[model samples]
Every structure is written in structure tokens, then in C-alpha cells.
Target: MRHVDPAGTGRAGAQAQPDDHPLPTPGTLPDTSVTDPAVNHHVNPRTDDLAVNPGTDPAVNPGANPGMNPERSSGTNSGVGRAVNPALNPAVDPDMNEVVGRDDLLLVTLDTLRYDVAAELAAQGRLPNLARHLPGGVWERRHAPGSFTYASHQAMFAGFLPTPATPGPHPRLFAARFAGSESTAAGTWVFDTPDLVGGLAKAGYHTACIGGVGFFNRRGALGSVLPGLFAESHWEPGFGVTSPTSFEEQVRRAEQVVAALPAGRRLFLFVNVSALHQPNWFHLPGATKEAGDSRETHAAALEYVDRHIGRLFAAASARRRCFAVVCSDHGTAYGDDGFTGHRIGHEAVWTVPYAHFFLDHGEPTT
Candidate 1:
């Protein structure tokens, strides 16, 4: 299920080119000491900025309640199988407007994850971190815009994320200013630029992209397009499909990126998690080298991903309240209907898991 390296190297774990621009030095970055919740009582300057903008309505800016009291969560928690109340906790609410413009944004594409597998793993307590954080403690079944990474991500950056399985004209969480967009609602953060990255940057966000799959590896012109949209982009062999610890490395890098941002700068962090894509047999317990990838290994990869993703959520939230969109770009076929992979129309390939939630400030970094 790995994409051929755009650099023509054919290696899934190709070395990435160095970033064109280096990150700011520690002294140049805004003081991030307010990450401590105890001293975070001061109002967020970004909230006031959005509020004063005549173009931004209060409904479009949800900074009024930047931090929702998780203690007020009506959901029951039993460690591995917790039920989250979307109404009480802004984090699990499907309403994107609840925290979008007001909070730092985190978009994580769980590459190649299928909806059925994600749901079943959460139910079985195999994806405990996700089960504990996802809205209603479940993955929302949706249809991917494209059957593969490159096409799907292109659409996502243009504000065409996976649509709900139920219907059309679904209000998008974010949108670019286009004349005939039916999905753009009153609450949608309509940006003047063509792509979300540019629009967010124009709106004062320090956009960053953490690459995982080949399309984002920056190995060639085609591979560089997506990541290039952001103000800062990063990739390497450890963050690619072949690495067993891709998600951990991505999270570690993400934490550093967040820590280095100016205190008042809003962050728009996008991470493409590649561990669940393919060559996932190693995630299974005592799996032999000859074992082929199957639905079993796919679920195991997701479980491994769930174990490490919590640190990412914690890091983003510790800096500021964050609105996160976590989902799969598309699913892969494991010999279903005689199909072995994606890029063709198939039930397994089109159906992916999706969810959006808030990360309250000062949450545990683990």
C-alpha cells in the first residue's frame, strides 16, 4: 500500500530534503511559559484579535470558552472504554465552530485506516486513547474524497474533507472564498486564499506540516506541493511508511514545533501518520516476516498509533486550546472483491474513519 517515492527512488523510507527555512531560535520565539494552566488565566491575545476583526463574528470565534471543564463531562470513563458527552465537552462536539477560529488547529490524517477497523478496535478497547478522546468514543464513518493519498489530500487542502456517509451539502468546517460553495455556512471560517494553509497563514496562524506518506516527503516537485503550502514542513525516513515508530517521531517533532512558536501565534499543525498504511505485519504479536498484511495487521497498526497519539494531543493542548480533526485520508483493500489496493473504487478504499475534537489547555502531555 506504499506509494512509490516521487523522487524515483522507490524506497518508502527515502531521506527528505532539508527544510528550505529553519525554525526560529529559542530566544526569538514568544515566551511559552503560559502553557502552565495555573498561570494561563490571562486572556489569549488571539481571541481579542479575532473579536476585534469586523469580518469575524462572535459565532465564528469560539474563544468565549477556550477551556471546557473536563470535570463537567457527563461521559463515563472506565479506562479503556470511555463514553464522551459531546454536549458538555467542547472537545468531542461534532460542531466545528465550537473551537475552530478560537483555538489552535491540529489536523491528523491517519493514513489508510478503515472505518470498520477503527470502530471495532475502539469497541474492543484496543484503541484506548482514541476511544477516550473521540466524539461519542467512536469513529464517524465517512466517504473519502479520493481513493489515495495525493488526490485525497489535494481535496482536503481545498476544504473538501471526507463527507458524512449520510448526505450532501454538509457544512464544511473550513472553506476558501469561492462563489458557488454550498457547504460554506455562517460558522465556516471562509478564508480569502485558494487553499486552507495560505488562508490560515493570512489569518495569522503559524502553519506547519509534518509529513508521513510519500506525497508529503518533499523528495520531488510533486511530493513537495502539499507540504510546501505550509509555513514550515518536515519529513524524514523515520516519519515515513516503512518506519515502525513513525507516529512517535512525528509527535516528538510536533511537540518541538509547538514549543518553538511565538506565545501569541495561533498554530495550524497538520500531521500525516503513516504507520497504519502498509507493511504493518510487524505490529501484530509474534508475527513472522512472511505474514502478509491483512485486516488483522491493519487493526494492530491502529492500536500502535493510538498508544502514541496522546502525546501529540497533550502537547498541542498544553500551549493553547486546540481544535483537532483526526481521520484517515482513505482506506486500503486487503484482497477485498479481488482488489489488493486503493486508487480504484472499492468499498474498503472509499470508506474511512473521521472525527473532530477539542484539546483543552494543560491536558497531560502523555
Candidate 2:
């Protein structure tokens, strides 16, 4: 929320401003013993009051404790709700009642992306919008219950993602289920009934899935997995294509899906981006499908996918009431320990990126 003036005078040893604006060029470093000229001369236009009292610390009253301010302890501090309040509870309102209007959920699955790649892109500002929404936390370290896509997605919808190892086989499987299940539940399985998506639908959410992979596409029995998971689903022949034109087609269909949402109703949209899968050379700028490619080409494909993802977020932000979860079903191995793609026991095949973003909404508690 801060703003910086790019044309302002440089403070030799001062820290960079908190705004996204450009900063002045670095020159000779300033002497730490001397006060910064910018701080001494620069005047805040928003405030007219300026007082400098020698030998007095403004942060703490002289009559109060040296470590704590009496005003803050008495709840009489003027800066109570400002940025530096110690008692500010950012996560207290998880239901997001403070934000008015309808709420919607968007879950995006970017297939085959690794956690390292996501961190690199995020550091480079390629995902500036997503970075702004995140609270500077780790978004890629969450584990998947299964190394493969189908099994992992099944566990995700069931609300039992992978966690650290357990003591025994029974405990491991119990970790794979919805927590808080009664021992005398009707079902024979250790898992609890009603997955997250189903629970959302039962709570009046309109659930929909836009399939993207061969496992999700309506080719054989694999097609039934995704469709049965949602209230409505769509799978086309070009759904999982790796071509550039196919990417545009998928975006077009996504636009149509967003447009079809009824007014005054909350919707849950799940989409899988398949352009970064194997045979992804066509996603490059001048590459053709016939030309075999390597992991370098896959990186290019991921960059392209990032751009499209930015577009998707832009569209959803326009709606102003959407929550987005972007992650990979599983990672792909590019000859790491002699493994090619996923479905194998390789660290590269299991460590995938995961990011959650909420637009005009607070964190999701359910």
C-alpha cells in the first residue's frame, strides 16, 4: 500500500522504500554516523505536524516501561489499528464477513511445475499479482498424497493431502482420510464421508470442473474420475493438447465458463492447465510438434503457462470475489535419477508448486 517517488533524491545508505515504484540509482555509500540527507530534508506532504524532541524516544513514553508503552497497554494508543499494532489479528476473521458481496472459488492446476521453478518465477516478479496476494509465506512445500496425478487429485478433493510420515500403516492411511472421523462411522473405510468439493456443493455452491489431462479427459474409464467429482464438467478433444493454439482454445472455453455463471450465486471452478506436459515443444515461440524437445523447452512452456495464468487472474480480479488455488497435480522428471516423467519414485516427480490466492476475500478456513 506504500508509494515511492522514483524522481526523489537518493539517500546513500537508506533502505529502499516500501512501494513498488522505481528507486534512485545507487551512488557512494553514506556514513552511518551521519543522518540521511533525504530523511533530514524531505517533508511529508500528507502531514503538517513535525516535532523533534532531543533525548526523548517517541516510540515509548518516558514515564512508561522502557520495553513497553503504557498507552498501548491501556488501549489508548492512536496507532492501534495502524500497520505496527502488536495485537492486530489478521487471520481472526476467516469467514470474510468484513468483505461484502458474493464469494467464489477458483482452483487452477498447473501440471508438471516444480516448486523451485515457482519460487524462481515469483522472485523474478513474473507473478507480481499472485505475490501481492500471498502473505510472504511458503506456497510450494505442501506435499501430495500420491506421486501421480490421478491419485493425488483424488486425495486432494477428499481433503487429505500428503503429510509427514506416520508410525504405522494404519496411521498412514488414517492420515490420508478426512480428520475427525468417528470410529463407528457407517462406512468400512478409515476415511470420512463427504470430500471438500462435495461438502461445498451441499452448502449451496455450484461446482464445475474443466478437465485437461488424459486421465481427466473423457477417453475411457479415466474420464469418470473428474466428472463424478463435480456437479458439472466439460471435456473436449482438444482439452489436453500441448499446442499453442490449443492453449488459446482452452482460455476461450474458460471465458465461456465464467460467463455462464448465474448472478447472485457462488461458484467453484476447477481448471487444469496441460500445456506444460510432455511433448510441450509446440508451446515455444517457433517450435513445431514434429521437433522433439527437452526440459529447456518445457521451461519455455511453463513461462507461457504463467502468462496465461496471469490472464486468468486478471479476469477473475475483474469479478472481485474469487479465491484461486494454483498448484500442480504432480511434478515431471526430466532425467533426474534416470526418470523421464511422473508416475515414478523420484523427488523431481513429487515436489510440485502450490499457491493459494484470494481476491477481495480473506483466507479460507473450510
Candidate 3:
């Protein structure tokens, strides 16, 4: 389903999602996304199958308990003997598999962060958190797959992050199956499922999502599309794209999930950081949340996001065998070339910051 670009563009764009709907608290996340007759609607804080807790944060702290059993992922429909399914077999010892150890993968998409803003922050050491992991990794500028969240993510989950400009051939770390590209590249992880979430599940990883922006809120039929790909998904009213404290709330929840994972389990964790998206004037000095977004405000927002990201990185770094990919979904217009918002063709909205690196491990390997 294609949606008209919120910023107004003549070209086709991503489908409109329930991001326009009133923000719903966690647990009470609207069921308007998509309803399968077979989908269970029961939700209880005590039940593991559909337990959801809403409005649990009063302050941002990364060490809080998740307050629930870590979600166990069942295998994708593909037929293969998976390594572990302890939820089904309580007697199975998780440590028996010595050959395969922790392979936790993390993807943090900085929603609506501009490339130039990031580069500026990195150079000034303002992003000292993510900067420590930048050595010998891919930090080049690239065009986003789409100008907005819903559109770009569809391409990203298909194993396309952002392609390098002036490129003859670009190497991909994770490759999704497509026609004619039947052969696998050396040292590259290959996925044959409909999307990366399914692919990771086939590889014996428990996948989860912590959403930030409205597009990811699981509000309407299209809203659930991305999060639905995971075994478990999380979102809250406080995690909205415009919320100043959304990233902090996300980190708190992420810390819970990370610590709750049973030993010897691999995690595929995905998050969308919404602080820099819009209504970002709150990040600027003397500017309130009610003010319009501006280049000055956007830069300040990135700094706010980076500070909390430091906390998140420290938490994830403590975990064993974790890998991370941090990038922006797309940039927004800051009155450049007379463009004030994203979606129309402009370099400000198209270019984004991208970095794929490993965490909790030693030096990154190619």
C-alpha cells in the first residue's frame, strides 16, 4: 500500500500508517493493526503468551528489571531442527551447545537524523558514545531507501540499508535472497525468508522490536507490519516520534529485555530512535516542545539522543556477542533549498548517517 508523502511529493511513497491516530499507551496498543481470525486477543500481565504492561516509567534508568520472562521465539514455518525451544522443552539445558555461543544482533535506527548533523556531532566529540565504535567501520554517507519511516524500513528489512553513491558495486554484510542472486557471498549472512526477522528466526535467534515513531506504533493494519515480523514487539505513548524523552524510555525497556534473555540465546533486537524526527525544538536551548523544528533544534536533538545512546551502548556492550547497526531512516528538511520538511526531492532529506559495527566483542571483523 502506497501513501502520499506527508511532506507532499509527486512521486509515490510508503503507505500511511496509524501514526496519525491518538497515541496509545503500552499494553493498550490498539488492535487496529491487522486482525487474523486465528490471532489471540487475550492480554494479561500474568500470562506469558500475551502479557503487556503499560505506563511503567517515571524516570529513565537503564538498569530496571523487565518484570517479565524473556520472550521465547518459536521457529519460522520453515522446516529445520532449531537449536533451542526451552519454552516447549523445559528440560533442555541451554549451555549444552558449546559450538554456537551468543550471537546477539542489534539494529538501532535513528529516526529522521540528518547526515550532516551526525558528522558534525561526531567531529566535535559530542557523540562520544557511538564514536568509540566507529573505527575501521563503514561511516560513509548514503542515500536512504525511502524519505520516510514506513517506506525506507520496507527496503531495509529486505537487506537493503543504504547504497553508496558513485558506486560500481557495494558489498553487503547481510544479504537477503532475491531472484538471480542465488549464490551467497563469502563471510556474509544470507537470509531466504520473506524478511530479515524471519531470516533471523530461521538462524535460531529470538527477534524483538522496540518502536519509537508513529509508523511503528502497531496502530493500524500497516502499523503492525514491521513489528509483526518479530516474535515480540514493544511500543508506548511516551515513545512517540515527537516525545523528547522517548529514547530514554526505550533504553530503559531495552535494558530489561537484554538482561532477561536466558544464557546461550541469540537476540535480534531492533529499535527506532525518534528524538530527532520532528517537534524537536525541545532539544534546543530556550525552545519549547511547542516550537517548530529547525536546523538548530535538530542538531540539539541529536546531542540529546547521543547522550542516552551512551547509556544504551554501555548496557549492550556488557552483554556477550552483540552486534549493532546504527543509522538514520531519513533526514528532514531544515529550510534548505526552500524545503522545510522531508518527502520532496532534496539532498537534506535523502542523505543519512549509517554505521554497521559489532559490540561486546573485540575489534570488528570484515
Candidate of highest lDDT:
1
lDDT (10s digit) by residue, model 1, range 107-156 = 99999998889989888888878887777788899999999999999999
TM-score of each: 0.75, 0.61, 0.70
Whole-model lDDT values for every prediction = 0.71, 0.52, 0.62
lDDT (Cα, tens digit) per residue for candidate 2, span 244-282: 654555666566555655453456677877787787887
Q: Which residue pairs collide, candidate 1? A: 91-358
Model 2: worst 10 consecutive residues (lDDT sum): 41-50
Off by over 4 Å in 2: 1-102, 128-134, 137-139, 161-193, 286-291, 317-320, 361-366
Best by TM-score: 1
True lDDT of residue 148, candidate 3: 88
Provide the lDDT at 296 for model 1.
92
lDDT of 3 by residue, 1-366 (tens): 222233322123444465744677887864333222221111111112111222211112222222111221222312221222223221111221121123467889999888988888888877766777765322568889899898899888987777665553444445564433422222234566777766666555656688888777766768767777776567777788767788898888777666756544456778888898888888888986556778888899888887788667655655565667788888889889777888767898889988765565432321
Error of 3 at 124 (Å): 1.8
Superposed by TM-score, candidate 2 places the C-alpha of residue 235 at a distance from the truth, in angstroms, of 1.8
Better of 1 and 3 by TM-score: 1
